[model samples]
Target chain A: MQSEFAVELRDVVKQFVTPEGNLLNAVDHVTMQIKNGEFFSMLGSSGCGKTTSLRMIAGFEWPTEGEVYIEGKPMGHTPPFQRKVNTVFQNYALFQHMTVYQNVAFGLEMEGADKNEIEKRVKRALEMVQLTGMERRKPRQLSGGQQQRVAVARALVKLPDVLLLDEPLGALDLKLRKEMQLELKALQQELGITFIYVTHDQEEALTMSDRIAVMSKGKVMQMGTPVEIYERPANRFVADFIGESNFLEGKIKSVSADEASVFVPALNAELSGVPMSKDFVNGEEVVISIRPEKIRIVDADAEKDGVFRAKVINSIYIGSDTHVFLDCNGVRLKVMEQNHISRLDPHSFYHKDQAVGVYLIPENTLVLKKEA
Target chain B: MLQRLRENKAWQGTLLALPTTLWLFVLLVIPLFLTLVVSFGRRSPDGGVIYGFSFHNYLRLIGYSTNCPAGQSACFDPLYAQILWRSLTLAFWTTVIVILLAYPLAYFIARSHPRRRNTFLMLVLVPLWTNFVIRVYAWMMLLREQGVINGVLGWIAAQFGLPFQPLQMLYTPGAVLVGMVYEFLPFMILPIFTSLEKIELPLYEAAADLGANPFRTFLRVTLPLSMPGVVAGTILVFIPVMGTFIVSDLLGGKQVILVGNLIQNQFLSARDPTFGSAASLILMIMTLIVTYFYTRKFGFGEEIITA
Candidate 1:
């Protein structure tokens, strides 16, 4: 029976020797399964092995210890040409010597397709990317966005079982990158091809991926749907890497089934939070993290379960949200208030040294194990 | 004063070019004009130019001889024509062999580890440090009948208890070709290596990622990208090989009478500067025509033509 996963990396590890003669694991022992027609992304900053993982899937690299399986078949030393996958490179590595038509048709020609077939498919691919009239121009003659689209068309023309994109929009400007992100998502859906994308941009992954594997160092820190990863992070690294969070170091005052009350010295009161990981014991150290946007600034006299009186340290008027810095007891927290109503009056905005109440919902506050 | 000098860009440019321009005008332009003038003159009885207009030397180069069989007014000797043709063929064969030998070595060096590449390139250039004539003499030592190669063969035959005769290797066409190949090899390698090394690694990955095997990638990407270097090396090796006489003179002995040896004989031995000047002009024209056609086809070696 064939496995359901389109690609699987079983405990794969890739090691490299730095120039200074240190053995480093570029991709640590990691395992993942990507379903067919799913848009999966490996997200991390540079040197975090995201690209290395994608390259191993593309057959440009081999697992140092384990095996990579595609369609339930082990890819043991199979070269990229023999593999049923193609990659749109980070820099749009198009053949500068070949014209756009020739570049897109390169893969089909390698497969020994006849002239009529190559021409028809190349024309169709170019049209899919909206580059129909750009066939005769060379790669250098096109703009960056156009070149990136050509790279996509070239890789997609072969209709591989899986498509790998290594930060394909990294070279484009911000505005163009956003547009390509939506276009790429729409394209992936229309074609129903499995895409293994690698990028360091967390927002891009959150925007386009069916699931994101946020990596740090050389290991997968967390892997889940975008909302799951954002709203409920697996650890401190994932929470901090995904979005801005205010972390308070504290000792567990009491432990319940899924909730823990942590005694934070900075707050001078026991704050209740849901533990992200299990095995929470009383007097154990943990960090309670609350996202900046999750905090609310209510009236000082309002009675709330997770509310504390605080003085506004500063305020910044941003269009979508107003960021208010506050000091509650001895702890500092940044509260983001969405502009639900127009604050035309000057007093409507929070001013310096104003008394306010900072509220952190027990469910929204994540109690995570403290990492060194 | 410094600001004034920098402000006049045209004057600064002229001043910077003064040394080279004066040098070329005196040493290159004046001599080339003199050679052309002397090419049209007649030969004196002595070794000086007679200074008269005639196409006798040019005509003789194409096999027309004023001094022929006594009864005939003119006849084709085919002597000068044969020498020119031999020179052309030798240069062509030498260039072809050098490229065949140089390209793989150059590619190997370019693809080697970065630290070792400099050492390999240095090895290719080490032979050039020796004098050209001395290097030709060294080839003579290896190709002579009693040379190291023949001595080894003789020793091998003696061990087998078989009688052997010393093989005549020097003063032959093959020896001349070998000597030429050895001398001009580095010239062909450097330019090819430069061009091959300039091809980015991503181009190869792109080709392989597009379903091309290693062989196809080399053919489609590596070969086309490195053509500029091959063209540059060809021009650099071909022209000099055609006009060089020391190799053919020493290694070919009396057997190889190329245009270079013929030109040298005219001025020093035959006491005919007019003929030598005409021959020199013909060699220059032949080299220019070949280069013109080659550059017109390949675009002046695509910016790496060292010459």
Candidate 2:
């Protein structure tokens, strides 16, 4: 049986030495495990050390502390070329002098494969990346997306144990990026190789990853599946970063094993949700997060126990849906409603400066413990 | 256009270019053309060209100087061919030496940390800021017997209790080569540095990602990308080295004679304008042929030829 983790980093720390002899911690104590045949993503904002962590795993960087292991073997001081891991950089870094065929064949050449085997493998790798028949063209002659595909083919041609991609599609256009995202996901599944992808794009992580480690300030903020991260985030940073949400300051009014009631200071009412964090005492300060789509809009005349009244401040007709901005108590809340058959012209019921009531889905709203 | 010419802007550009273009034509091109014309003419006793045409200068260059006096062997002799051959050989060796030395230095300047790179390049160029003659003269002092180098060698030999006579380092072919390399090394470095600087680091990283080691990456990627600089630097160093005279005149004493020395002797000491013109024309033709092949080999097409 295969090992549980294909790539593992334990308390990896990387500090860059300045010319004046000061050290700046670029990657600080990052520890994570990537499962075999899984598309694992490290998502974070810029300068958050996600790429540094990925480089450490790829053997391009040596951690200042702790070790990086791949396939149950210690990669103590291995160079990047000697490691059985390949990287696809953000800029697609294709060799400008070589043709596409030669770029893909470079690794096979290094492996000392037979002439026929090298040609066959290079062609196969190019086919995998859908870059067949353009083998003779140099990088400058190709489009950005094509260059990116060639970079992928160059790395994938090595057939390493794990493939590390540092925002590989960042250079492509939106349409091309989306297409490549799907292609990358399909390719990962078909090849069944461990893929450790790094990106600042949450949508990309949500779309392609089997599991994601959300990073911030050189630390892993949370790690879980897409649905788990979206439905039940660990903290304010993860919740606010992964998706759109409205957070309200509150205090716990009643605590239970599975449920809790938090009194919202802004609305002057009690809000109920599943307590996703540690134990909370009564009257303890807490925060509640609720997705906009989970909140339902009701007319003022319609009476509902869980409904709270809100005034429509602004409304936008976005092609497939209407984005309604409402003032709940003193705070503004955005609500997205679909233009489905059952909800035809929902905005017709309300206009700007008109009052309406919002019903929050108790199950969708989460009560997170107050972070220091 | 004539209409646009009336706008005065055209005249301004023409005015700006007038002095340099006229200088080049009158001082450089006209003199060269005069030399070519004189190459086919007979020499008057007064050291001016006679309008009569003859193949005597060419025949004399091929060692048919029988009509010339035997005592004037230094002025009209078969040594011109040997001088040309030696100049070519020395220039080739100098080009090779400078290129090997400049490559690593250029690569370091191009790829090292930006804050220190400028300072390093400036240090390399500091010696060039001095007058060329002064710099060559400084080498004379350094290489002379009982100079700074000899002082150091004598001191080291004294510590070992060995014979301490100053070594024969002055007025030799070796000293001339040292001066030539020192004078032309910067010309080789600057172009190579420019080309190396333009090579993106991502290209090397991509090569590594494709499983190539450092050596293979340099051979497959960096070397090909920087060939333009290599070609430019080689020609820049080689052509001038072949034509240079002062370094050899000062450092070589009477030990050697290059093509440039022969050319100078023909026009000055020999007072033979016809023979000098023939030699100059031959050199010009040889340079043109070599340049054509060099640029063509490096894939420089109309761009370099026209430039």
Assess each model's interface with DockQ, reporting 2 decimals per model: 0.42, 0.41
Instruction: Evaluate residue B206 in candidate 1 and report its C-alpha lDDT on the 0 to 100 scale.
Output: 76
Q: Model 2 clash pairs?
A: none
Give the per-residue lDDT digits (tens) of candidate 1, residues B1-307. Answer: 7898889998899899999999999999999999999999987666788898889899999999878778999888998999999999999999999999999999999999999999999999999999999999998888798998998999999999999998989998999999999999999999999999988876777778889999988877787778888889999999998899999999999999789998899888998889999999999999999888887877734322111
Off by over 4 Å in 2: A17-23, A273-278, A341-349, B1-29, B52-64, B67-78, B300-307
lDDT of 1 by residue, A1-372 (tens): 656999999999999999999999999998999999999999999999999998888888888888899988899899988998999998988877678998898899889999999999999999999999999898989999999999999999999889999999999999999999999999999999999999999999999999999998889999999999998888889999998899989999888888888988887878876655557888999999899998888998888777889999999989988999999887889888898889888878988998888888878888888992
lDDT of 2 by residue, B117-230 (tens): 899889889988999989889988898996889999989999999998887877888989999999999998999998999898867776666667899778777877887898
Query: Highest TM-score among the candidates is held by which one?
Result: 1
In model 1, what is chain B's TM-score?
0.94
Chain A TM-score, prediction 2: 0.94
Assess the local accuracy of residue B21 in candidate 1 as a C-alpha lDDT between 0 and 100: 100
The lDDT values for all models are 0.90, 0.84
Residue pairs of candidate 1 with colliding backbone atoms: none
TM-score versus the correct structure, for each prediction = 0.94, 0.91
Worst 10 residues of 2 chain A by lDDT: A341-350
Local accuracy of candidate 2 as per-residue lDDT tens digits, A206-320: 9999999999978898999999899889888888898888888889889889689988878888877555566778888878888888888988766766688899998887767
